[model samples]
Target chain A: MKQKRMQGNADLQKLTDLAQQLRRDTIRMIHHAGSGHIGGALGLADYMAALYGWAMQYDDLDPTDPDRDRIVLSNGHTCAVWYAALARSGLIPLEELATHRRMGSRLQGHPARKAMPEYIETSSGPLGQGFPVANGIALSLRKRVSQGRVYVILGDGELQEGQVWEAFMTSAHYKLDTICAFINYNNIQIDGKVEDIMGIAPLADKIKAFGWHVVEIDGHDTASIVAALSEAASTKGKPTAIIGNTIMAKGVPSMEGDAKWHGNTPNDAETEAALEAVGTNNRFKDFPIANRA
Target chain B: MYSGNKAMRDAFGDALADIGAQDDRIVVLTADLTDAIKVGKFKERFPERFYQMGIKESDMIGTAAGMAIDGQIPFTSTFAVFTTSLANQAIRVNVAYNNANVKIATSHGGVCVGADGATHQAFEDVALMRLIPNMTILVPCDANEAYKATIAAAKMDGPVYLRFGRIPSPVVTGADDPFEIGKARILRDGKDVAIVAMGAMVPAALEAASILAADGIKAKIVDMHTIKPLDENTIIESAKECGCVVTAEEHTVLGGLGGAVAEVLAKNLPTPLRMVGVLDTFGESGEPQEILEKYHLTYSDIVKQVRLVLKQK
Candidate 1:
C-alpha cells in the first residue's frame, strides 16, 4: 500500500512540473504578444496543464483522430494557458508559442478554429457560446459506440450568460456521461470582481440544482485538480461540473488576486519577477498563495 | 384541426421521425417550441436524442454545436423569426465558425405566418443566414419538398438552413422528386419569359406561367430553392434563353431569393428583371391568404410583374 502511495506521489510530482512549465509558457506567450488575458490564464494554468498532461487522452500526431479525447475552451479569453499547454504537449511546436496574438501568426487573441489546427475545435471569442458548443460535442461523442470524452473550460464570469444554465439543464437531462465541465472560479472579470459586478454566488449549488454532479477543487493544486477530474470521469449516469476554486492572478506578487490584471500585461521588470516567482527552472518551486475576496 | 397554416410545422415533425428512424445520429433540439415547430413525433420516438432548450436560442445553438462536435447531426427547430434573430450569433459562431454539421429547421418563415404579425413573420432569415460562410440556404416549396429537403440536408456535410413556410401550398413536385441543394429545377420551359421563384411562391409562379402562356407569352418556371449558391448557371441560361425575368419569393425584397437572383443577373447578364416580394414593409395580423394577397404574393401579382418587366425590355 505504501509503495502504491509513493508511486502515485511521484506521478503527481511530474504533473506539478508540467503545471510550472505551463505557467512559464503562458507568461512567455502573453508577454511576447504584448497583450492577452493574463489573470484567468495564469489562474487556470495548473488545471489545464494537469488535464492535457494526464487527465485528457489525445493524439498530438492526429488531432482529429476519431478516437481522441476533445478539450474545448469555453471561456476562450483565457487562451494563453490553452495555447501553452497545447505547445508543451507537442500538439504544436514549442517555439511557435512566442507568436501568440501576433498578426499572421496561427495563434489569435482568442481561441480561433481558423487560426490553429483542427484540435482548436471552434472559434470562441464571444462568451457563453462555447459552453453549448462543447455540450453538443459531448452529446455527439456519447452517441457513438466508441468511448470518447469532451472537456470544456469556462470562466466564472462567463457563467453569467443564461446559456450556460440552459446547457447545464440539457446536459443533465441527457445524462451525458462523457462530458465534463471545468469552471475557473477565479472571482474576477473585466469590469470588476465577479461578486460585485454580477453576483453569481452559490454557483456550485445552482449547477447541482440543474442536476449536474458537482466537484469542487483547488485550481492551482495540480494533484487536487487531477484527482477531481478522475472523480468526475468515474461519475456515472449524469454530466459532471468541476468548480475550480482559484485566485485571479495566481503567481506574481503584485498582480495576485487583482481584477485589474485580468487583461493587463506586466512590464518587462514585472514579467521577470513573475517568472522568478513561479521558478526559473520551469518546475513548481512554491505552493499556491491562498488569497480570497 | 390545426388549420392548413400549420401543415409545414406538422410536416417538419413527420419528416424528422421518418428520417430519425433510419439515422441514429439525427438528434432534435428545440428552444421550448418542440410542439410549435411540430417536433413532438420525433421527440416521442427518440426521447434520448430530443433536447428541450427551454426558450434560450443562443444556448440551444451552442449546445447543438457541442453535439455536432461529438459527431451527432443535430437539427435545431424553432420559428423562423425567433431562430433567425435570437439565435443569429449561435448560427454564426457555433455552426459556421467550426463548420459544424448542424441543421437549422426553421418553420413559419415569411408573411404566410399571418395573424401573428411581423414579429412572428420571418422576412430577413435568408439574408442573414446567406451572409454566413459555409452556410447552405434551402427554402423548400411545400410539405413534399420540405421532407425531401430535410433528408437532403441530413446527408449534406456542413451547416444548412432548411427554411419552411407556415401554410401548405399545393404539392406541386412529385413525392419522388430528388431535392438537390444549390441546384435549380426547371418546372416548365418556355421561350418568352422566365419566372424564378422559391418557397411558397413557386406554386404562384407556376400559375402565372399558365396565365402568361394563354396570353401568347411563353413563360419558363424554375424553382431556385437553394438561394445562397444562387444557381448562377441556371439563371444565366434562363436569361439567355428567355431574355426577360421575374423573381418571386415570400421574403423581403432586400437580400432574399429575388436579391440573390438579381445579383446573379446584374453581374452576369444585366438582363431586365423585376422582383416580386415584400417591398420595405412589416407584416400585420390576418389570415394567411389575406396576408399573401395584401403583400401582393399571388399568381396575379407574378403575372403583373412579368408583364411590367416584359414591357421594360
Candidate 2:
C-alpha cells in the first residue's frame, strides 16, 4: 500500500516536471515568434499538464478516437501552453511549436481547428464563446453515450462577457455534469487588473448561484489540480467549475503576477531568464526556429 | 386576404418535425420561441432532442455550433431580427467560420411581422447572412417551399440560414414544384420583362405578371429563393430572353433579392433593372398588409417596377 502511494506521488512529480518544461517551451515559442500572450499561457501550464498528462484519455496516434476526451481552450490567446502540451504528448511534433503565429503555421496565435482539426476541437478566438460550445460538446457526448468527458479552460477576464454567464446557466440547467470547466483566475486582463477593469469577485457564490459544482484550488499545484479534476469527473447532476487560483506569469520571477506580460513576448535575455526560472535544461535545443517575418 | 394557406413558420415546424423523426441526430434549439417560431411540434414529438435556450440568441447559436462540431445537426430557430442582427457575430464566427452544420431557421422575416414593429421585423437578414462565407441563405416562396427548404437544409452539410415569414401568405408553389438550393424556379416565362422575386413577393410577382399579360406586356416570373449561391445562370438567361428585369422581395432593396439580381445582371448580363422592395426604411406598428403596402411591397409595386424597367429598356 505504501509503495502504491509513493508511486502515485512520483507520477505527480513527473507531471509537475513536465509542466515546468512546457512553461519553458511556451516562453521560447513566444520569444521566437516575437508576439504572443505570455502571461496566461504560463499561468495555464500546470492545468494543461495535469489535463493532458494525467486526466484526459486521449490517443496521440488516433486523434479522432470516438472515446477520446475533448479539451476546449476558451481563452484561445493562451494557446502556447496547450501547443506545448500537445507537442510534448506527441499529438503534434515538438519542432512545429517554433513556427507558432507565423504564416501557414498550424500553431496559430489562437486555437483554430482549421489549422489543425485533428487535435483542436474548435476554432476559438472570441472570448466567452468556447464554454457554451463545450457545453454543446458535452451534451453531444451524452447523447452518443460515448462516456467521453469535455474539459474547457477559460480565463478570469473572459468571465466579464455576458455569453459566459449564459453558458454557465445552460451547463447547469441541462445538468451537463460531463463538462469540467477550469477558470484560470490570474486576476489580470490585457489593459490592467481584472478587478479594476471589471471585477468578477465573489465568483464562487455567483457560480454556485448558477447551480454549478464549484471547487477553488491553487492552479499551479499539480496535486491539487489533479484532485480537483478527479472531483469534477466524479461530480454528477451539474457541471463543475474549478476556479484555479493562478499568477499571471507563473514560474518566472520578472513577470510573475504582472499584467504587462499578458500579451507581451519575451526578448532574448528575458527568454533565457524564464527558461532558467522554469529549471528546464537544453531549452528548445531540438526545435529549429522557422525563418519567417 | 388570408387564404386557407398555412404560414411559412408552420410549414417549417412541420417539416422539422418530419425530418427529426427520420434523423435522430436532428436536434431543435430555440431562444424562448418554441411556440412563436412554430417549433412546438418538434418539442412535443422529440422532448429529449428539443433544447429551450431561453431568451439568449447568442448562446443558442454558439451552442448549436458546438453541437454541430460534435456531429449533431442542430436546427436553431428564433425571430429573424434577433438571430441575424443580435447574434450575427456568433453565426459568423462559430457557425460560418467553422462551417458547422447549424441550420438557423428564422421566422418573422421582413416588415410582415406587423404590430411587432421594426425592432422585431428583420428586413436585412438575407444581406447580413450573405456576407458570411460558407453560409447558404434560403428565402422560401410559400409554405410548401418553406417545408421543402427546411428538409433540404437538414440534408445540407454546412451552415444554412432559412428565412420565413410570420403572416400567412398565398401558397403559390404546389407540392409538385421542385425546391433545390442555389436553383431558381421559373413560375412563368415571358419575353417582355423578367420579374425576379423571392419569399412573400413571389406570389406578388405572379400576380403582377398576369396584370402585365392583360396589358400586352409579357413578364417572366422567377422565384429566386436561394439568395446566396444565387442562380446567376437563370438570372442571366432571363435577362437575355427579356430585355428588362424587375427584382422584388419583402426585404430591403439594398441587399436582398433585388441586390442579388442586380449583381448578376450588372456583371454578366448588364440589362435594365428596377427593384421593388423596402427603400432603406424601417416599418412601424401596423397590420402586415398595411406595412407591406406602406413599404411598396405589393403586387401593384411589382407591376409598376416592371413598367418602369420596360421603359428603361
Candidate 3:
C-alpha cells in the first residue's frame, strides 16, 4: 500500500511538471504564432497533461493503431495545448510544434484530422461538434469491440450549442460508456465569461438530465483529472462528463481568470514572464532559450 | 430497361440492409425518419448496426463521421434538407474537412416530396453539397439506380452525398447496367442536342429524347448522377458529339446539377447549355408532378431547354 501510494504521488508530480511544461508550450506556440486562443489552451493544459502523460495508451511507433485511444479536441481553437501535449508526450516530433498555426503547417489553427491525420481523430473548431464525433468514435469502438475509449474536451461555452445536447443524448441512448468527456470550465469564451454570455447554470444537472455520469473536479488537479478519467472508463452503461472547473490562462499568474486573454497572444515581455510563471521544461529548451524568463 | 416504378428511398433501404449483411463495418444512422428514409429494413436486419439517432441531424452527421473515421462505413439518413442545410456545419467540417468516409444517403432530395411543404423539400441539397470540397455527390436517377449508388458509395472512400427521391419513379437502369462513381451513363445517343440530367430529372430527359426523336431531332440522354468529381470526360465528349447540352434536375437552376455541368462545359468544352430546373424559387405543397411541371422540371421542360440550347449551338 505504501509503495503504491508513493508511485501515485510520483506520477502526480510528473503530471504536475508536465502541466507546467504544457502551459509554457501553449504560451510559446501562441506567442510565436502572434495570435491564438491563449486562455482556453492554457486552462486546458492540466487536463491535456494528465491525459497525455498518464491516462491515454497509444502505440508511440504507430499512433494511428486501431486499438489506440482517441483524443478528440472538440474545442479546437485551443489546439496549442493539444499540439503541445502530443509533442511533449513524444507522440509527435517536438520540432514540429514551431510550425503551429503557420501557413501549410500540419498543426492547423483548428484540429483538422486531414492536416494531422494520425494525431487528430477529427476536424473540430465549431463548438459542440467534437463531442458528437467523440460519441461516434466511442460507438464505432464498441462495434469494433476494441478496448479503446474516446477522451473529449469541450469548452463550457460550447454547451450553449443545441447540438451538444443532442450528442450528449446519443452517447447515453446508445450506452456508449467508452466516451469520457471533459468540460474545460474556464468560465470564459471569445466574448466574455461563459455565464454572462449564455448561462449553462446547474451544469451537472443538465448533463445528468442528458443521461451522463457527471464527475465534477478541479481542472488543475492532475490527480482529480486522472481519477475522473478512470472513473469514466470503469462506469458502464452511460458516458461520463467530467466537469473540470479551471482558471482561464492557468499557470500564467498575470492572465489567470482573465477573459481578455481568451484570444490574445502574449507579447515578448509577457511571454518571458508567462514562461517563468509556468516553469519551462529543459526538454523544449529550443522553444525558448534558458534564462529568457 | 425499366424494371418497375418504386420509391428511390425504399430501394436505398433495401441496398443498405443488403450491404450491412455483407460488411459488419457498415452502420446506419437515422434522425427519426427511419421509415420515411426506408432505413427501417436496415434497422430490422442489422438491429445492432442501426442507430435511431432521434431528430438530431447535426449530431447524427457528426456521429456518422466519427464512425467513418474509426473505420466504419456509416450511412446517415434523414430528409435531404435536414442533413444538407440544417446539419450542414457537421457535413462541412466533420465529413468534408476531415474527409471521413461517410455516406449521407437521404430521402426527399428534391422539391418533389409533395405535401411535406417547402421546409422538408430540399431543392438546394445538391448545390450545398457540391460547394464543399472532398464530397462526392450522387443523385441516382431512379429506385433501381439508387440501390446501385448506395452500394457504390459503400465501396468508395471519402464523403458521399447520395441524394434519393421521395416519390416513386420509373427504373431506367437495368441490373447489368454499369453504375460506376464519377461515370455518366448515356441512356440515348444523339447528334443534334444533348440532355444531361440527374435524380428525378433523368426519367424526364429520357422521355424528352423520345419526343425529340418524333420531331426528327436526336437528343442524347446522359444520366450525370455523380455531380461532384463530375464525369467531365463524358459531359465534354457528349457535348462535342451533340453540339449543345441541356442539364436538368429537380433542384434550382442556380447551382445544383445544372451549375456543375455548366462549369465543366465552360472550362473545357464551352458548349451552348440550357438548364431545366427550379428557377431560383422555393417549392410549394402540391402534387409532385404538378410542382415539377410548374418549375419546368419534366419531359416537356427538357424538350424546351434542348430547343433553346440547340438554337445557341
The complex in candidate 2 yields a DockQ of 0.74
Chain A TM-score of each model, in the order shown? 0.91, 0.94, 0.93
Q: Give lDDT tens digits, candidate 3, residues B187-292.
A: 9888999888998889888998898899999988899888988988999999899889898888987888889888888899898888888888888898887787
Across A36-154, the per-residue lDDT of candidate 2 in tens digits comes to 99999999999998877778877766778777788889999999999999988878888898989989999988988778877788888899878888888888888899888889989
B-chain TM-scores per prediction: 0.96, 0.98, 0.97
Candidates in order, TM-scores: namely 0.90, 0.96, 0.96
Q: Candidate 2 DockQ category?
A: medium
Q: Which one is best on DockQ?
A: 3
Mind listing the fnat for each candidate? 0.90, 0.66, 0.88
**After superposition on all CA atoms, how large is the RMSD of candidate 1?**
5.2
User: Which digits, one per residue and each the tens of the lDDT, describe model 1 over residues A97-154?
Assistant: 7777877877888887767646787778788788777777776766665577778888
**lDDT over C-alpha atoms for residue A119 of model 1:** 76
Candidate 1: which pairs clash? A132-B62, A132-B63, A133-B62, A133-B66, A136-B66, A136-B67, A137-B66, A137-B67, A137-B70, B115-B286
Which regions of candidate 1 are displaced past 4 Å? A1-10, A65-67, A103-105, A114-118, A145-147, A282-293, B1-14, B176-178
Error of 3 at B214 (Å): 1.4
Which DockQ-derived CAPRI band holds candidate 3?
A: high
